[model samples]
Target chain A: MKPAMLYKLVILIGILITGVADAAAHTIIVHPSLKVKNISQALQQAHNGDTILVKQGRYAVANLGIDKSVTLLGEGYPVLDGQMKGDVLIVNVNHVIIKGFHICNTNKGSLRNYAGIRCESVKNIIIENNRFNNTLFPVYLPKTSHSVVRNNVINGSSHENTTAMESGSGIYLWYASDILVDGNSVSGQRDGIYFEFSNGCTVSNNRCKNNYRYGLHFMFSDSNTYIKNIFSDNGAGVAVMYSGHIIMLQNRFEYNWGPAAYGLLLKEINDSRISDNIFGHNTTGIYMESCSRNQFSGNNFNMNGWALNILSDCTGNRFDHNNFTGNTFDVSTNGSPEQNSFDANYWDKYAGYDLNKDGIGDIPYYPVSLYSKIVENIPYAITLFRSFVVSLLDKAERAIPSLIPVSVIDHHPLMQQYRKS
Target chain B: MLKIAKYTVYDIARNKIILSYAIFLLVISLSLFMLDNDPSRSLSSLMSVMLIVIPLVGIIFSTIFIYNNSEFIELLVAQPVKRSYILLADYLGVAGSLSLAYLIGMALPVTIYAPGTTGLYLIVTGIALTFIFTSIAFFCAVISRDKARGIGMALLLWFFFSVVYDGLLMGFLFLFNDYPLEKPVLFFTMFNPIDLARITVMMKMDIAALMGYTGAVYRDFFGTSIGMVFTLILLAIWAVIPLIIAVQIFRKKDL
Candidate 1:
């Protein structure tokens, strides 16, 4: 066939598919208005390309496996109480939509992966605007793609039990691709939003707080974008590990404090961009180990215990145009063969004069202090942090630079806070 | 010994240098507190001054004071007073006077402006530095007969503690920079009193961030109770050993 004929044939196929959908689609209402009393009965009576509209009522249901090209629409936020038996709903087929339901109390299932709603091996679906309570692995999507999980509220496992840290996550995505998880509020789970082996995903505008472990944990997930998310008061804010090509923008990581806790732990991540994030009150903000070629720009590190704990072996990472205010130590590194760049950041500890008035500082700022280096090797020496000797040593070193990673220099430090354009 | 120590303290208390030292401390603390809006920055400013100035004054003042009052010391020695008593009295006199000045000059301002652990830490470290340095001064003064050489020795001691020691540590670290030196460096810090004093305060200030994982490891070793006790005992040793050496020298000296 000619090129034009092939295009016409593709359009004809698209029209035929839509026509078949329109022809087979039916609306099945499960309510007192009809003879059907329960959703299961309505579902049994429905066919492919059907819409099962459930009315407002308490429905005590068993495991629901949806395997059709259907839409399950709930009216007035109908409650689906599982009474602690098994997964409330499971979607085994593709091209499905489940919206506007309140689901709760999914009990122990056989696979140890029983979820409130599990989408297994499904494609082209949308699970939106639902509220979940006490559901392990709520909105679990395994091997899914080209789907959306938006505007949902998940009040996952109770935080009262300390062992809740081992429970399931709020929205778990494994082996998923091109998924957009947006505008969700999740709390009280092992992790609020998790992505494992998921790629090309956009996790944006989520409020994940007070979780048992990490609010957002990304592992082996590549080419993802996380923007405008607030992760706070969790055991740790987020852990992005063994991944690359990540763009983290405009996120707020706050108040994640503990001996082992941190705002963001980036390990073995390469060619990533972390920009415009606010890191506040975290024990260690942005702890990087073995990460390379990452760009950190326009971030605000405020009142954190340790703003940047960039360990040894991290190289080619660029820290530029960030504002460091009131952190205990703005930057720390183990003395090793390392190469990284710190440029044009506004440091509160900068004592250099901008005599030329070009908005950039005339002199460079050494983010690593002398005493910090001493304490790095001799941990007990931190007790002497406030001592005059350490202060003078740091000042003296700052004046006549030596020993402490001279390669990591803020060559063009900003006199003012760097405002992102 | 107590009576002589009391009289010496009173006598040194009235001296112009003691008064000026107190006044200088007062002015610096008050000015630093007033100048920086951030309480932490001001605390840092006060701490550095306390570290550098306190140790220097303790050594210089005690050496000069003891040497200038050699006639008085000889007069006391000529009396029925025990040899140990006279030396102990002069040492107590200088250390007590300096300690009082530091407490009066620093403690009040710190309590008023930046109270809590910060104030308490600064005061404690200031007191330790004072006691340690004065004892060192006493040892240097009693060990050497020439006043000028003694003063030179004291100044050199101050310079070594305050500057050269750190430079040397930096050099040692550079020589062995390739190895994992956290443990060895920590052991090395205990040898220097100034380094010891500095680390104790920094740990308290929670700038452990600077230390990173090394800091956490330090905290694990120190904890709260054990760390403070360790610091106090180390400081006590620093004070007592010097004074004992001074007493030994004083016993054998021909005044």
Candidate 2:
């Protein structure tokens, strides 16, 4: 009843929804030689809807807190150094905009989250085109909504010392809603983008690279879409846990390799759509545990170890029109007697002939081999992976069916590799 | 060559020691399976046993077999038979008998209790190890005329490959700990036959979690068909290359 009501409400009054933009009534220029020595004094003298333009100069200051609805714009990327203290900029009121500032060098406080910019209980905030460097957390928002954070460059400390629990990450959205995070390049943070209890957000076109932990962490967040993001060189990769109705589209996961690493880890995620993504050179391209009702289609998995690893309890997942090429193993899973359909995917391991020349194999291809089953049952059996006898057993199993599970099968295997436009 | 091979196999088949070897494997594998209902656990236990005992028994038995049959080999050399044929036949006879015994002993218990990929892998790797170590034994025997020296050399070779090689690999990794050793260590692993055989079986077992990053790297390398083919070829070369060298050396030696 609620879902239908929402649809009807959107349909009936869709044209009535429009945004009102407020105009700035006052303008002030802040220079080093002016009465306001720095941004803090300028901010103190400013009122609501006022725009303070900061000229280019380096400011060595403590935390700058804003309590009014004002715009703090930098004319030439004014340097705001935190001097190894706390947050460089803190916004406590609504309708604030912090743009074009080069904020850097915040010491990672053990108890508190030291960030380049922190927003508390604020709405309609615009944080854009800023550069953040050597900060523990950058662009952090708590209990805020309807905000935009885009075109930011966030660089953090070396990812090696990421074992600290509270440390790392860029652009953490906590208890926030309807946020737009786009066009950001985040590197060397534990996780590039982390969302906790945030919903209805759109994260797109972000390049997240070389993070020690996950490139993106979506925990307990629902109705979020991550589109066209590139996640590379992060061994912990991307983990989407306890979330539902998420859309992952056209994302590229590459070069995330380690023993426990994977391109994507989906745990307790349901009703999700993973479509048109490229997963290349990862240890395990996609690993799902206790996930159900997920649709995986049009994804390219290339040159990965253990391309798809599904746990025993996962069910009702469908894999269709996905290209599996040059991967070590197409699929490995614990013995799950559940049903999942795999259809029309191009597999380099497919040996069946296309009898009618329709580019579809005449026989159904079993992507799960006997050796994969062995490795699944006994993880230690992974050591025998390169033996001659193992290959011979694979061949023998191909000719003669053995104890390999037959739950997952691609019915209409394509004769050629899948090409997308 | 076929005639000598046939005679050698027939002679080894009637030997009491070979019969006892088959019975020994049967008892050990069956008891291991009976003790544990979980097929994977049993297979792991049997794997360790096979790793240690197979190489030891293979090298020792083949070395003794060659020493005992040196007189027969001399008689064959005096005949119209080629020296290469005599060496090849003797090596094949010992390897074949040992592998056959291994198959008979492991087959019933594995097929009945385990009856899956793990069972099949155990059988296959076990047979390959038998063949490989037996060939190495032939090389040791052919190189030295002293009976005690040949047996001692075979034992030392097994110890070096099974134990020393792994230690050296660990030490090398420790020395280069600062560098990314994942890619280089894979190439280094190919030099040792025991490591190859053990890894082949271990990769099938469920212990990737324990192996962690190193395990994942190994899985990436060995999970492919190409890696499988390469490792198999390497194992085959390990078995055949020594026999080839042994044949070459035996050809010029005085009986």
Candidate 3:
């Protein structure tokens, strides 16, 4: 090749490479005061990988749909009003980014899919730093995958509005996968974070309080990780049902008290890990039914009505290295001869001392008693929990190990408390 | 009366303030609609617009429209026409013009973008809110002797309807948390026009999940044919009550 031609070819290759790189990452600015008259037109004109930056102003428009890989950003509280028509914003594309906008006043129609921001079948989307105010539903993801929803403030104050007919949620994911919801403050809605039929998701570092419904509710969502989240003053702290391979770690479940309140309620869950969580001031700390092979460790059960309520059919579970302190009832199990093991836990009511200084109790502790077993079957018997007859019967049952499960005793119980810090 | 209505519409069309508002709305609405690719996403964006801009235009335009049109009102009163005619004409004129402006500015973009019942509902809501606020401004103008006080009252009314009413309802719920007043709560919500508007539009949108159980009860009660009638009746009251009060005050006023 000629020397000049070779140099030109090299330059052409460099230009092509740069063009490809630029196509992968593009930037678009939406001036706060640019005052564009049509949002649809602007979106239609935008390229697949471009970013739309919206400045601080009220943008009154109708339903917006996202179908391409793009980033939409709002600066200084740019408002997106739905005019009470339908779902405000819907995302149908992959790798899209939405941040920093006040989204509100969504219309709650009987046929509408999601109210605030609905993502359908999209993947690898990021929604962050946004404020959803007075919307019916804040962030809804259906059949989407690999999405990160973080650092968002979702407020749904439907206190006096009778016009809203649907249940509102701060972040609702259904049939989604590989989702991560973290560091969000959600209040005054139905469910703060709800997952149904979702798998392989992580919910962590989120503050979900004062919601009318559950703080974190999952049904048939398997292989999910929940860590370091706070669920306080909601109708229920957390509910896990028909799920497996779930990990619940370092979370705090508090102040979820009502006629039917629980810190954590597990129904038909199997092969899960529940560890390092703090449960306080709930009606029941952990209510389990038909859950098998789940390991419970290093958790603090404090000031709950029943620290552990293991119903019949819950088998092969392990409770170890946990601290049960100041709970109204340590453990209540239905039926005889439980299949689960309770070991190495620090019980506030432990009578045996660790004379050998091995950090393990000398005597095996029977967490379940005949009185508790009776109360489990006839719940009204709980009113006589502190009565002399019940205490005497409980002591007798613990010493004898007759009606309750023989294997339910905490062998090698911890003499010293296990604290997360 | 018809001439006054026509002039009011023409004057608002020519007014620089309204023109700016129309342009601003056009720009923002268009940007929001175009930038969003999902219809549902745009619905949320439009909701933010409605909550902020609807009350803003309703209060600001109505206040200024009343204040600036004081001379025109006085001139009309000086003529031999009925005071009721003058007030009605003024109301129709201002409301019609602003509604027209709102329609042209917002309706066009919404129709082009969504082109569904939702867009049409929004246009109707915007127009309804404009008329409702105009009537409220007339009432304020008739009651207050000073223009400043009148504007102040109008703004306060807007604030109450938009923000404070919801707050007060929450306070009530908190105070009476022990009592189950779900049915009564539905009845109570009907008194606020903003709540009425929210309910009416939401039912149309089919996203009742946002409403919760109480909202569902209300929907069941009011989403029926009878409920539709009741809603229309309430909306009529929203229009008629303020106009009637304004007319009554205008008829006897010394001005």
Candidate 2 residue B219 C-alpha distance from true site, Å: 9.8
lDDT of model 2 at position A405: 68
lDDT of 1 by residue, B1-255 (tens): 999999898889777789888888999999988976777778877777887999999999999988998999999988998888899888888899999888878888899999888678778988999999999999899989999999999999999988777767766765786777667767877777887777677666654353345566665544477877997889889988999999988977999
Off by over 4 Å in 3: A1-28, A31-35, A161-165, A385-393, A400-403, A419-421, B1-255
The digit string of per-residue lDDT tens for model 3 on B132-164 reads 877887888789888889888888888788667
Q: Best by lDDT, which number?
A: 1
DockQ of 1: 0.19
- Better by DockQ, candidate 3 or 2: 2
Q: Per-residue lDDT for A118-237 in model 2, tens only?
A: 998889999999998888788899888999999999887744555535456788999999999999999877799999999999999999998768899989999999999999987588
Candidate 1 lDDT over residue span A231-265, tens digit each = 99887678889999999999999888776778999
* Maximum-DockQ candidate: 1
In angstroms, the error of model 3 at A368 is: 2.0
Off by over 4 Å in 2: A1-24, A158-166, B1-252
Chain B TM per candidate, please? 0.96, 0.95, 0.92
Docking class of 3: incorrect
Span of 10 residues, lowest total lDDT, candidate 1 chain A: A379-388
